[model samples]
Target: MPVLLTKIEGKGNGIKTVLPNMSDVARSLSRPPTYPTKFFGCELGAQTSFDEKNDRYIVNGAHDAPKLRELLDVFIDKFVLCKACDNPETDLTITKTEEILRDCKACGERTGVDMRHKLTTFIIKNPPKNPKKSKVKKATADGATTPNGDADEDAGGDSDDELTLRIKAEAAELTADAAIAKEDWSADTSPEAVKARMKAVEASMASVSLAPAGGDDDSDEDGDSPFAHLGHWIEENREESAVEIYKKAEEFGIAKKHNTMTIIAQTLFTENVLTEIPKYAPLFAKMVTSEKHQKSLLGGLERLVGVLHPDLTPAIPKILMAFYQTDILEEEVITQWGTHVSKKYVDREISKKVRKASEPFLKWLEEADDSEEED
Candidate 1:
């Protein structure tokens, strides 16, 4: 691809480097124009501004064509090429576990991208607008249809008969297995058997305890679970300061639990959470001292956004950005949460919706990481 570099004067940043043909270059790479433009900003430690309306991609500070081309090559190697076959025919996918997988169509190899790179986060959030789907050509005895609808030469009649026999054998084996599975069930309902089962159930019930052992004083008030008690306390004492809440959690004797942060997150914020995050950011920063606590806090936010305030679902990206900017959540944790869909805190569909709403912020986080690395 050709690099068209120009010097733009009278801009906010004097003598800015402009890429007039960035859109065409991005088209050749099958990526959005913003990607390479933002990449240049990252690698050069310079501010970048994009005028999508006019197709103007500008980077602060003057840069030559050769230097920009070199950086573009690095971007292609890291993001575009297949590691195994060095093929550029690859697609990027973000797995449920937040892994960036580069799947090659030419070599049929699936490889992982370096998660440490900041570009990965951007790619995960942006992804391909229309991912190229690999077409499978099914060959028959008569002929095989190509990707373009062209047919190949015919094969022997024996090949068809052999394939048919194999398919029939597989189907018969599946039917036989199903029949055997159906025959393996039996239940006893005789009078003596029923009496024996009743006695065993009675004995098991007798050994169970309905209350805390030794009448523990620390048992939750009103027979609620510890987390429930904490949540109720926070809701009732909403006027209490963050420090007071932290102290109260300690008094509740459940401060050490993983779900403590989860309860706090769900109970503390309402629909105005985006504006309220900075107020509680310090508390969260202190409480989330470990990865487990971080994940628990995320679970709480998941319920807060996905269940408690479904109306705020559209603001997930902004909410996450607030937490990120305030140091309430780290990039690694946010990226991990954004990539995963968990039913632990909300329904699977709700979890997916929450993540989908967070894509824009996630992409910004990644691009920021790249710029930081350049610095």
Candidate 2:
């Protein structure tokens, strides 16, 4: 239902229905766009194309916006919206026997996926990863106070109801995706959003390691460094969150090293690190509190930013935005750090570029604060 706009590309038999709002809709459904796109293809008997890099989903033939939207509603009804409570907060869990179950958060009900549906086959093969910790965190936060002054066990609220409506309304937007600029600070902490972010980081890591070793990139082979060995641990432990990774580094004596922050900055966000930041903010509470650590943090960040393609410089803004949102990266700290340039962690030129890259986001944050004061 998310801003259900479609663009038709090409002519004759080669035409396709490109859902511009595909990613937005998937966010509403709490499922990946591939699931719904593949569902549509199976339902319509048409081939589907997925361009993950651009977040584009295309199905063969020209399908009317209303028709596809209707299909999306059906998909949501069966797979997304909880049956018992009619809520959107649910997790698809697969049992050892491979039975697919919908674990409803709102009503504590267990509903099985329709085994007869063709989508079941795909669902069975690609079981959606359960985001349990984030869910528990959200549930606790959403809990209302009881008359006894204890938090309610049943975490139902008007906020959830409002969220359900907002998702549908935003999806129906003909122009924008959602009011995220104002909301991401809070909403980015949700279970589904966190999972989506991890998946996105995994997708982006491919491009991060693409550039060669000449100007600003690391020259040593991935086989050379102790950090590379730590990175291997990250690859092997796909299910572990960043906090776990940081602890693992401690267990291996990597966290105490003077170079630990630098290594972590390189290896952290490569696997669900941003999604883990809010969950592990307490672990990093003192990270930038001191002048010495702040310098090290900025140095690590510079090294991490050095190898990425220049086109991705815009990411500096969003990275800073997330840090500011989570209160992990202090505004005063980042603003001061951005003004001074040093090559302590990375090449001299790379240090200058990363700071330059951070300037726009810092300026935006300053203007935002000024506007808030005026209001």
Candidate 3:
């Protein structure tokens, strides 16, 4: 996140609404009536040129208009230059100049101007750029190639359709797996067969991996693969015997990712991990109006732990506490929670509430580390 503070010097032409505080430039350009000018007696009320073809107002003579240039020298002694790159050659024309707004011309650094000083930081989050759309031979109704010479229909739709189909099929199989796993106790099947069948189903599902294939092997591409360990675990624990899959996940680090972890934890609670309290605990302590997802996630977590650790009673609170402090959970999980909370609930609660709630768990983790060192 980079904070840019710029001083508003002079009034810019009001017609170009997007111009950042180039008002001083405009004031300098306007004549005092006694001064001589070619375009005489034309009282400029924000002079703007209309691009009829594009249907947009463009600033053509705002910056270096002859009258404006003279005023700039008289009134404005100095202009605000970008601190990151001290280039005085800044075209304050808001609408037309795409290059300046998109990125810095001098240093090639991305820049945005915020009028105020509060930490309105801009972080550059670049998405993975995929291949551009290739033009195919689009057959017109008359069986002739279109003017653009590109097939408009079924070009992009084909890939999207394929992805949708894959997701739907995967969801259906998962549903079936859940039903089978739940009823394995009453079903007429050997435990080994049940396990084997489940494994096969899981393998088939796993084959439809989400990662884009045939890309350059970029090691620096550090990303969390969304192949849910829970999906794999569900397949692993098809047997009626042993511990439930959820419990094992808790024991292991399955729901370590914070956002997913929070959901899992919430799911566990909803499944009555706390039989002591029939009504679910108030999740999103900072957020007054709770998110339904927080409840669902807690239920999932409870079920996971309950299934895995049926025999040994789980330290539900401790596990929840542990999860809050986990870097994986805090980094991955809380970011999502923050996003959901901010979007659905009050935006203010996201930063303050999440940070406050997570701190206890973080502090507890530090103490645990200290104890281990002492031991």
lDDT: which candidate is best? Answer: 1
Against the reference, the lDDT scores of all candidates come to 0.63, 0.58, 0.31
Per-residue lDDT for 1-375 in model 2, tens only?
A: 456788888899999999888887786565778889889998899999899778899999999988988898888888887778787766687888888788664444678878888888888887774332232234336673321234645465434335334433332331222222211222234566555544433333332232212233332553244444454465444455545655676665545343444445554543234454444443343233333344555555565456533444546655555455433455556777888786555557877888787776667556545654565
lDDT, residue 53, candidate 3: 37
Point out the higher-scoring one by lDDT: 2 or 3.
2
Of the pair 1 and 2, which is ahead by lDDT? 1
Candidate 1 — which residues are off by over 4 angstroms?
A: 1-223, 372-375
Determine which window of 10 residues in candidate 1 has minimal summed lDDT: 131-140
Task: Give me the candidate number with maximum TM-score.
Answer: 1
After superposing candidate 3, which stretches have Cα over 4 Å from the reference? Answer: 1-234, 237-297, 327-375
TM-score of each predicted structure versus truth: 0.41, 0.38, 0.20
Native-vs-model 3 lDDT?
A: 0.31
lDDT-based ranking: 1, 2, 3
Candidate 1 C-alpha lDDT tens digits along 294-327: 6777877877787666898878776765565443
